[model samples]
Target: MPLRRVAALLLEPMSVFEYAVAAEVFGLDRTDDGVPAFEFITAGPAPGEPVALNTGGAIVPTHRWSDVLDADLVVLPASEILEEYPGELLEVIREAHARGATVLTICSGAFTLAATGLLDGKRATTHWRYLDLLARRYPEVDVTIDVLYVDNGSLITGAGTSAGIDACLHLVRRELGAGVANAIARRMVVPPQRDGGQRQYVRTPVPECTADSLQPVLLHVLDNLHEPHSVTSLAQRAVMSERTFARRFSAETGTTPHRWLLQQRVLRARELLERSDASVEQVAADVGFSSAALLRSHFQTIVGTSPQRYRRAFSTT
Candidate 1:
């Protein structure tokens, strides 16, 4: 279904950046660039009521909570986590989902969605800082860790301010196709595909080397993705032993060197597929995969679709 209508529920003590992420993606006028316009509205618990912002000052929402029920997409931006959200607000969100409106929560907004009982037995992720708490507090919800967002068909949750942008763009890509999603990303000057499985975890207490010390090697790998790289070679590039390098890489990237490189190669293949008329064989070579079959195997595992179908759905050329 086309996502033509959007309503963002404004909770008290709102995080300005997360709310702005929703507004900037959905509320902006982008039809001139061939991106469809969303009938975006911000609403409070009560119609025309003022909701307090954590950054200070109050925003008076012109739409009521009831208006959300009619929206095709309902946004829940990060707000202060509380033991309980207003019953009316929770019920309206519940009804909206029960009637088939797709619900997206940004960062700590997962807390609000959990209160509505929709996350039970479903995988969900919030900001990394609250990962443990979310898992412990909501035992029924299968709280996933180290992901930018979790998508379960009708419900999605994003982590942190930047991840919110990723989730919103991903939804646009899912519902409106890549051309529209890419157009909006171009307007916003952001990368359209930060895969949901990418890590958003914070620094851990595991005694480790300097954070991001492997950044140069990582950047070099990105620049030389077509080249064959191994843990030994990458470790040499970072001036560390293989064991130390592997540990540091995991600490920094939340994935092993092989898996990370595999993901990057597939992502590069996606871009090539979308923008260039490269055959799967050529794209596989371009992204450092040994053969088209290998690329297909890894691509399907990470992207949940084959290259040909992804290209057909998202290719611009």
Candidate 2:
């Protein structure tokens, strides 16, 4: 019932695009349908000075870092480089987080926030290209490299540059409602929703399928997830030795073929569990698992919950 106060922390060499995104969504008073308007302010390390941006532009902040203690949400725009995160910046972020403000970061800006130890032991994402580095840099942080973004309640991190828009839209939906977020998306001509599980841009597209390559075989395996197939049989169908087929499959998918196939089966089982009233045994059979026990074992291992619990949690509406 009260106005939400949002502050975007503008650091030197700020990303104008990310900053503009924060302003458009939170700073502007666009409440034509009676949605609550937020009290938005740009804040800098120092009070009331023009902050330099990477887009050859400057924006003067309305407040200093001290004013951020009262903010409900604080956005950290993407940092220009991975190493520019300073101790002062880390302290500001850490203090804001300690005060219970939702700290959100876009792309590599997560690196800066993570420097404060806020994201440690929490699931988060950053630009997918820098994912391995993020994981390596902050081994305590649980990095999910594939998702569009991760929402850890108190802290949110987005993958890549454009995924920042997705995360911001998601925040609008979470804080206001879907109607407000959809209206903003319509105005921007962007898709209203992309699941957090959606893939970011693939770094290097797989080489085009060759006559002897495993792409065709992989497709068939995916299409028939319920089928019982063996490595020997698959290699025979492709007219290659098992070792050669495994090597080529790994090159194409960045994972072993067996692991990929098992993951797909787990995915299929989850869909059935979530969408259908079938018992765990039925879903297991439908997804090529030999038994419900095997299904429950793998489902809990991969989906992080029992099949029955997953079904109950995500039953079709």
lDDT top scorer? 1
Query: What are the models' TM-scores?
Result: 0.66, 0.66
In angstroms, the error of model 2 at 153 is 1.0
Per-prediction count of colliding residue pairs? 0, 1
The RMSD (Cα, Å) of candidate 1 is 8.8
Candidate 1: C-alpha lDDT: 0.87
Best by TM-score: 2
Which 10 residues in a row give candidate 2 its minimum summed lDDT? Answer: 198-207
- Local distance difference test values of all predictions, in order: 0.87, 0.78
